[model samples]
Structure formats: structure tokens, C-alpha cells
Target: MWWFLICLAALIGGYFIYGSFIERIFGINEKRATPAYTQQDGVDYVPLPTSKVYLVQLLNIAGVGPIFGPIMGALYGPAALLWIVIGSIFAGAVHDYFSGMLSIRNNGASVPSITGKYLGNSPRHFMNVFAIILLVLVGVVFVSAPAGMLTNLINEQTSLHLGTGAMVVIIFAYYILATIVPVDKIIGRLYPVFGALLIFMSVGLMTAISFSGEHTIMPGFQFGDMFSNLNPHDMPLWPALFITIACGAISGFHATQSPLMARCMENEKNGRFVFYGAMIGEGIIALIWCTISLSFFDSVDGLADAVSHGGPGNVVYTSSFGLLGVFGGILAFLGVVILPITSGDTAFRSSRLILAEYFNLEQKTLKSRLMMAMPLFVIGGILTQVDFGIIWRYFGFANQSTAVIMLWTASAYLIRHQKLHWITSIPALFMTTVCISFILSSQTLGFGLPMQISTILGFIGSVAVLAYVIKVAGKHKNLSHSDKATDNLTRIT
Candidate 1:
């Protein structure tokens, strides 16, 4: 109990102190015109109020992630506490803030654009493909997850019967509508309502846990007992836990999503609240789910059994239902179903913008938006029929892999300007190791290699990446000087 309380306190305190330090490091300017103002196109680049942008960003990055991801992460026991708190403060929030600020610096460019400017053309092209695939996967997963939940709700609570296939069509229709319309038309208007539900459910769950009696509900998880793997499968904690908990900790997907809000932000200073602060808000939500999942079950084994039997949805449904009864059922619907739908829409929206930017097409008109969006939805709709677990596992891997690229890109940006680069550099190196090891050792992707060999490969990969980044930075510096010398000689001549 003390450990949980302390972790919660630290996260809240870190947001004000550590978050402000990051803000200073980024050197945000109040007077400079943002892309939303200078490049307002009445479509994707329209300016939004600070409050609206903050809410939309929060809900956009969140989706069903904080709920489902943390529930699964809790399979490792209280170690999740450490990851959510530390990762959110040092890694997740920092990743999000820098990514958003970088987008603003680049005329509201997508992640691939920013990556191209800093990491060069080849990596940018790779990232373009990687981000588009990840977004489409997100769209598929969100659609399937919510529709399945809605089907379950109807079957469980109502006499009116609806199959998942029907729900899929209905949800996909709404997704297409949201994706093709103007940002202000669908996402900007509805996200606030969904955001309010998220806040209400998180706070309500926290309150329920607080009052449910310490001995029974709050089982007093300790920091010292956190290291012993509570997972029934004895899953390695290094990469699996990190990948399982991407959203509440550090996610690459946030970088793709940030550019959308970046296009709407009114000022550079608001980056902290919209980008960094929204991540902290997500961390809080993930923490609540983590705590509730652990405390609600009789033991770690019981939680694991529930998850194995029914999936993370079981945790959401059982915990919320037990704690708040009928009201908890409603909260589960909002948290699990409504939230992901919101994120799915934005995922497709970001995909549309990325495609528009890639092909150099105007998005100011409906015809152009529909032309880019129809193919994405067709693929996403096809994907909803594939196995959900496989899609989710790949999404998690791609999510962290993208984070490494974005982090390195940010590091290169800082290095080129001669600012402190270690902040992004250290995390980039760490996540790079995690992603590489997960690939080499994961049963789904890799050969399920031994942990020792995986660790060794991770070490080599991290070193190689760091060497490449340093070499590139040096070349960029030299190129800048060479261009400067040429300009000087030409002026003098």
C-alpha cells in the first residue's frame, strides 16, 4: 500500500518538476507563430483552443491502451508500478513532448518528415511505411476491440441480439465518416465527451479502491517483492514487459498522433500541456488499471487465469463490475469500448494526413480526403477479420520500434543544434536495445532464442546504432560548416 501510494505521489510531483525541466530544455517561445496560424488550411491545419487540443491529444493517444495494456502488464506483478511511474516520467512524456515540438518546428510535418530532415532520406522512407502500417493496425485493432465489447454487452445485458460482424460494419462506417470529414467536424467535437468519460472512470475506480478496505481490496503490494516474476509463463521482464506496457510508458505511436495535435496547437508553449501532460494523464489512467487489476483478484494466479480464460476484457469487466456493481458495468463500456473508437478515428485521420503529405496532395476538399481514406479503411476492414492476438502482438513490437526511431531523430535534432543530446540519446539507446531483443527472442517474431544470446545481440545492436548516430551528427556538422564557408566566399567575391 505504501509503495503504491508513494508511486502515485511521485508521478504527480514529477509532472510539475521534471515536466517543467523538459519544457525549459525545449525552449518554447510564446511569440512565434505556430503552424496552425501560419499554415491554416481550414482542413487538417486549423487552429484549436488550448483546452480542446489538450483533451483531443489525451484521448487520441489513450484509446483502449491504458486499460488493456496495463491489465496485461500486471501479469508481472508490482514491477508494473515501477515501469509506469519511471517510464512515464523519464521516457514516455519526454518522447511525446519532443515529438510534438519537433512537428511544430517542421511546419506540422508527420513523423516521417521530421525523421527525414534529421536522419536522412532512406530512414524517412522506411518510417513512412512503418508508420502507415502501424496506423492501419491500430485502426483494425481498435475497431475489432470495441465492436467485440459492444457485442458482448448486448448479449449479456440486453435481449436484442447483435453479432460481431454487424457491429464491425457499423463501427467501420463511423470510422470512415470520422476519417474523411474535417478534423473539426468529428474528432474535435466528440473527443471531449469521450475524454470526460475517461477522467470520470479513472477517478471513480481510484476512489472505489481507496474505500474498499485495505486488507481485502488493497493487498499492500511492496517494492521489494516486485522483481519476482508473477507471470505464469515466467516471461522475461526486459522486453516483453516493456512492449506490453507501451502506451502508459513510452509508445512510438504517440509520435504519429502528435503531429495531428501539432497542426491544431495555438502556441509552442502549449506543447507541454498537450503533449507531455497528456502522457502523464495516460500514465495515471494506466496506473489506476494496474492497481485495480492486481487488487481486485484474489491472487496473481487468479488474475492470470482470468486473463487466459477471457483476455484483458475479463479484468476490465470483473474489476469494474465488482467494485461499482451496475455502474461499474457502464464504466467498463466507456473505458473499453468508447475510448478505443476515439483513438481508431484519429489513427485513420493521421494516416490520411501522412498520405496527403507523402503524395503532395491538397486536403482542403472532401474529394481529396476521401480518395486517400477509402483504401486505408478497406485494408483495415479486411484486417479486422484476422486473428486479433497476432495483430496486437505485432502492433506492440512496431509501437516500440517506432519510438526508437523518433527518439534518435530527436537526438539528432538536438545534436545538430549543439544542445544537450543525452536526454533523448540515452532513452533511444535503451529502447533500441529493447526492440531489437524482442525481435530476436520473441516467440512470435523470432526463434525464441535464449535470454543470454538475446541480451548479447541487444548490446551489439545498441552499440552499432549509437556509432551510426555519432557518425551522422559529425557529417551534419561538417556539411553545415561547408555550406557556411561557401556562402561567405560567394558574398566576399
Candidate 2:
């Protein structure tokens, strides 16, 4: 419990101390006009209040990843604590801050566009396709996750016999409506309510933990035993821990979502609060979930047994009821349900904006918005037929892979301006290693190589990539050269 409180403090402090420092490095300007004013598209680029943008961004990135991932990561025992705290402060918040602010600087450009601006056209084109695919994957995953849960909840809690198929159709319809509408119409209006549900759920559980003999219920962080791997399955801790705990610590998906709020931000000064502050909020949620999960089942082994029976979904259900009772648990269930649905809506919405930015298509017109949106839903609908496990396996690796690119892209932008580059560069190199090592070491994703060989070669590949990133950064060291290159590109509507 003490460990949990300390981590909570760190996440808050990270926003004021580290987040503000990153803002200064990026050089936020109050005088400059944002795309919400400059672009002035009624659908995607409409201006929103800072408080609303913060809540929208929070709901956008706070998908099931924060809750489910941390619960799963908690299976590794106390080892997950360090990654959630340190990674959120240094790596995750920094990555999110730049991904949004860079887009704001470039007139609300998508992740692929911003990456292309700094990295190169090759990465730009690759990311253009890659980001759309990743967003589609998110849409499919979030749809299925919540729909299935709703099916069960409705059937058991009410007289309604809702099937997963029916629930999926309902969610899919809501997603399509949310995707094509104006920025403030569906998403901006509803997300604050959803955000409140999320926080209320977390607070209820926290209050329950406090009254339930917390020290005996939750283990304190220990220096000696903390860093040790406690996975019941004895999985390798390095890449697995980092990958399992994405979004809570750091997620590439946040980069995709950041631009959505970036277009709505009225001022550059709000970037840290909306982007970095949201990431910290997510970390706090992750920390709470991780602590509650570890303690609720009496032991890590017991938690593993529950997970084995029903996966992380089971962990969420059983733990909520055990800790919060029947009435509170039902409300908690609604909060959990909202997690994926909110993300699913924005996942498709971000894809529409990304395709619009990439193709230079205007989103203000109904036809133009539908042209980008319909095909994404079609692709996502087709993928609903694919196995969930296969999609999930790729989502984890791809999520981090995108993070590596965004970090290096931000690093290059810093180098061009001759500002502090290592803030992003170091994390970029580290995540590059994590992504490479994770893929090579996993049997389904890679060659099923042994850990010994994978670790050694992953480092080698990451170092080689780092050297190339440096070379590219060096080419843009003259701010005039980089500025000229940016000025030449077409701005996205």
C-alpha cells in the first residue's frame, strides 16, 4: 500500500516536474494559431476547451490496456511496479507529450505525417499504412472485448438475452456514427462522462482497499525482492514485462490518439496537461489495478489460476466483486465496459483523421469523411472473423514498434532544433531493443529463437537502428534545412 501511494505521488510529480520540463524543451508558444483555428474544419479540427480536451484524451488512451495489461503484468508479482512507475514518468509521458505537440506544431498532422517529416519518406509511407492497420486492429479488439462482456452482463443482470454478435453490431453502429460526426458531437460530449466513470470506479476500489486491511491485503515494494521475476509461468522478465505492461507505462497507441485532441486544443500550453497528464492518469489507474489484483486473490499463484480459467477478464470480475461487494461491483463492471467502447469509437475516428491527413482529403464534407471511414470499418469488420489471440499477439508488438518510431522521430526533431535529444533518443533505443527482442523471442511472432540468442541479436539490431537514427538527425542538424523541408510539404486538412 505504501508502495502504491509513493507511485501515485511520482506520477503526479512527473506531470509538474518532468512534463513541464519537456514542454519547455518543445517551446510552447501562446501567440501561434492552432489548426483548430487555422484549419477550421467543422468535423475534426473544431476547437475545444482545455478541460474537455483533457477528458477526451484520457478516454481515448485509457482503454482496456491500462486495466487488463496491469492486471496481467501483476502476475509477475512486484516486478511490474518498477516498470509502471519509471516507464510512465520517463518514457511514456515523454513519448505522448511529443507525439501530440509535434502534431500541433505541424498543423494537426497525423502520426505518420509527423514521423515522415522527421524520420524520412520511407518511414512515412510505411507508417502511413502501418498506423491505419494498427488503428483498425484496435477497433476490432476493443469491439469484441466489450461486446462479449456486455453480452454476459446483460444476460445475467437483466432479462435481456443479448448475444455477442448482437452486441458487436450495436457497438459497430455506435462507432460508425461516432467516426463520421463532428469532433464535439458524440465523442467530445460523451467522453467526460466516461472519464468520470473510470475515475469513480478507481476511487471506489481504492477506498475499498484502504478499509480492507491494506497492508495485509497488498504487498509493499521491496528493493531486494522487487526487481526479481515472480511470474508463475517463469516467463523471461525483460521484454515480456515491458510488453505486457504497455499503455500503463507507455503505448504507441497514445501517439495516434494524441492528434485527435491536438486538433481540438485551443492553446499550446495545454499540451502537457492533455497529453502527458493523461498518460500519468493512466499510470495511476494501472498502479491501482496492479496492487488490487496482486492482493485480492491472496497470492500470485491464486491470481494466475483465475487468469488461467478466464484470462484477465476473470481477474477484473472476481477482484471487483470480492473487494467492492455486489452494488459497487456492478458499477465497477460498467466502468470496465466503458473502457473498450470509448477506445473503439476513437480508434476508428483516429483512423479516419489519419487517412485524411495522409491523402490530404478534407473531412468537413460528409462525402469526404465517409470515403475515409467506411473502408476502415469494412476492414475491421472483416478482421472480426480472424482469431482474437492472433490479433492480440500482433497488437502488443506493433504497439511498441510504433512507439520506437515515434520516439526516434521526436528525437530527430529535437536534434534539428539543437535541443535536448537524448530525452527521446535513449528511450527510443531502449524500446527498439524491447520490440526486437520480444518479436524474436516469441514463438508465434518470430523464429522461436532461444532467449540467449534473441537478447544478444536484439541489442545488435537496436544499436544499428540507433546509429541510423543519429545519421538522419545529423543531416537535419541545421534548423534551416529541416524547416525548409517541412515548409515544402502539403498541409493536411
Q: What clash count goes with each model?
A: 0, 0
Score residue 95 of candidate 2 by CA lDDT: 97
Best by lDDT: 2
Q: Per-residue lDDT tens digits of candidate 1, residues 1-493?
A: 5666788888888889989998887787676678888688877888999889998999999987888998899989888878999999989999999999989877899999899878889989999999999999999989988888888777877898888999999989998898887788878888877787788888897788778864254475555657767787888788889999999899998999999999999888799889999999999999988888888886678789889977998677777777787868677555668888889988999999998999999988899999999999999988988999999999999999999999999888778766788888888988988988889898878779887798789988987988887778757764475324422311100
Off by over 4 Å in 2: 159-161, 213-215, 219-223, 481-493
Candidate 1's C-alpha runs over 4 A off are: 214-220, 478-493
State the number of backbone clashes in model 2.
Answer: 0
Instruction: Report the lDDT tens digits of candidate 2 across residue range 1-493.
Output: 6777887898899889988899988888776778788877788889998988998899899888998889889988877877999999999999999999999888899999999988899999989888887899999999988887778767767898866888889999999999898989988888888898899999888778778863355655366657788888988888888988998999999999999988999988788898999999999899988988878876788889999987787788777777787788889988988998999889999999888877888777889889999999998999988887788778888888888889989998898788999999889888988888888889878888888888888889888987888888788787765586544534333
| TM-score, prediction 2 | 0.96
Local distance difference test, each candidate: 0.85, 0.86
Leading candidate by TM-score: 2
Q: Estimate TM-scores for all models.
A: 0.95, 0.96
